[model samples]
Target: MTEQEELVICVPGQRLCVADKSNVAGAGTYEQQGYIYSKLAGIVKLVTDDKTRTVEVHSITEQSIVPAPGDIVTAMVTVVNQRFCKCSIKCVGDIVLTRPYRGILRKEDVRAIDKDKLEMYKCYRPGDIILARVMPMTEIHSYQLSTAENELGVVIAHSDEEIRQMMHGFGDSSEPLFESAKIIEDVVLQQMKIIVRRACEIADRRANSKKSNIINGEDLLFLLRKDKIRLQRIVKYLELKELGCSVQKLMTANDVPQNVTDPEQLDIKKKVPFQSFLEQIDNTGELLENSSSVDDVKRRRCIRADIASKSMDEVHYMKFSKARRVSFANKNRHKFSDWICADGDVTVSKQAYTILSYLAYETVAQIVDLAFLVRQDQGKMHGDAIDRQRLNYINPFTFKPRYHSKNFVMKPLTPSEITEALRRYWSPQLDMTGPFNRWSMRRPHLKLLSC
Candidate 1:
């Protein structure tokens, strides 16, 4: 992704000039949109005329790979000026990013927070590592990049390359950020699968529609959210509604369930207790929808480690027989060994705790139990844990919940229980204006609720 790493891709619709490392031009440099590929890695720079169609590539490496949509590029913040911070892309593949192509990161695209009072020093120093998404390629070969994304900022801080690798995705994830980062990969892969799967599923869903009520755009968006891969399945379905209810019914050859809440009540608002909250005229839903969808936020949670971590004093769970687990976790973790980093494997990031304590330490059974409780809450269960009517999900691995218990077998959370965490190396108060997607949606809801 770096400029020196090799010019892999050109602008989406436009191709730029390229050359090889030996100062030889693989493809001659050409001019387009008032800017020409002035400099190319490896080969000598070729100054072409305005009328030229193809670009002269210098020192072409591997036929000059080009940048396209959805390429993960890593870069370092070289300049942190007042209005913007500049950096050169690095690493396209295992080749080790070389050529330093300049990319500008406007102050707005830095993070998700207020901009005027943001301190660049706290968010990003001159040498801070940044992993950003390529939002757009602007004029003059400038890449319009964004760091406001979760898991898009620095990952593996500290100078140790090996530790960086572990933080990135190498060793057993022992830190919250590291583990979240690991999960991010899983989620991304899942998203890719979803995108592909949905296509075919929609087709089949459409084919089976008894009423021939075709799915619409809105339904496509919803399908994209639930499981992107499902949309690409055998059902070449289409929908006008984002909920995709129409498409689901068509594909399955069944009646699309109405938005009614209760089986018999018919009115969802009456059945749901949060009716008043949903009925508010604060216009929060629109804001949230425009910024970030609820589903998008959850997906990003798995993808990016830049989540909030409600931290407290490191209180140990003494009741549980975790002495051996704690000792083992501390001894093997790399962050624990580094005096600059781990203090007995306890890192500063809240995400570190989530990684070490829950995801890493707790067995999969415990995780399943936790996931069940969370989902139950999402399912709108009410009352104390002891009085819950029913459990939402059964652990596939466990095969059963605690017998004779109204709720799943679980203990009350102590104050030290870390609810959420964000694994990152940047200061708070990033560019708040950038697209939060699902997380962003909550802001409007939060604002309305706060009032």
Candidate 2:
């Protein structure tokens, strides 16, 4: 081919011009069986002189490069062990490679002196960038590397903990500070941008799933909840925000008169009247009754007496105890007499009857809450009642008749059967197993029991 001729593109192993005295194989080409064949998928070129011609194949793009013997390469250590360190060659000589090639550095090839005493971990670590000379290809698709020379070893080394500390502005002061204030600021800004981008992506995905465009605070809260430590702070902040209070005010506010009109200004240490405490309880009950959101239900359930005391006062504590006693007396007034004269032989005290009634109410309330949660998890609306199967699952106390049995009787479980059921369902945790075992032993003769 002449310089004026049309360009001929040839792939590897494709036959080109015949090999003769006037034509010879050049770079990217090989002479085989009296024919010049292309060794690379590129354009075939011909170089002519007065005596002979050299046929070659040149790539359509930049010249193809690979790490060859004695060529220096930059590699990032992927793994390091006692025997060898594995890395991926990122650059050949001064040229950055488009794709990484596998390289291995044995412990013996790490340094020239004391090769036998050299430890791979001491010389290099994972994520370390190192310079090494390519020895030769020993295995398929992998290059043998060596850093025995004085100037070829770990060029950059930073442990994960070091990187984390640097990111948090707590890096070691002993080391030379190469990073400037601007660089630190830029890194922080870039990190914030990434976090914001990730949060937006999550919110957008959730909104898309709901077939909506508006992302709400709940989505951001969901993201925060993924980090358990941050979740607690976020929850506290939200609770304080909802109550129209701040942490500083809550900490510094003094005990004031109960006559304070604004709830936010009310002193947590001030004594709350019995009537006011009762009113708060009634309001809480009303809120629970009218709650439509599952989150509202959860929030209400998390309200503890101690947490409420933080906003109210110690006077409410005594009032709360008295109110509970009064409520229990009113609820079991009629049943107290029946419980005392039960079967004309057994007698039950008012306190015992009240305790039983309180336990029964608590269990029923918990079952109701669990049923609502199960229905919500099933993608049901607030108005939707729990299905029969789910209701049975939530309230295991419900009698499920064994219709398939020969004696299909509708009866309550015996004491032994109840104990067995409790043992089977309850996990072997201290709180659960200790109480259960003690209760079972104390009431081994009881006819019926409900968890």
lDDT of each: 0.38, 0.50
TM-score of 1: 0.25
- For model 1, the stretches where C-alpha displacement exceeds 4 angstroms are 1-63, 93-95, 158-451
Give lDDT tens digits, candidate 2, residues 229-342: 333333443344334443345446675544554555554432222223224434334421333434432343334222323332355344444433332234444543332223
Q: For each candidate, C-alpha RMSD in Å?
A: 22.7, 25.1
Please give each candidate's TM-score: 0.25, 0.32
Q: Candidate 1, residues 1-451: lDDT per residue as tens digits?
A: 1234333534223434333332222342433444444333434333334543233554445434333334556777777777888877775333344455567778888888887777764576555667877665765676767878777887545332222232322111222232333343232223323322343345346567433233233323333233323322211211122124434444486544554333343222212211233234224343112232344322432332211111111331221212212321234444433322222322133322222222222122222223334544444555355322222222232222232323222222211221211111011222254344345434222111000
Query: Model 2 reaches what TM-score against the true structure?
Result: 0.32
Return the top candidate by TM-score: 2
Candidate 2 colliding pairs: none
- Candidate 1, residue 79: the lDDT equals 70
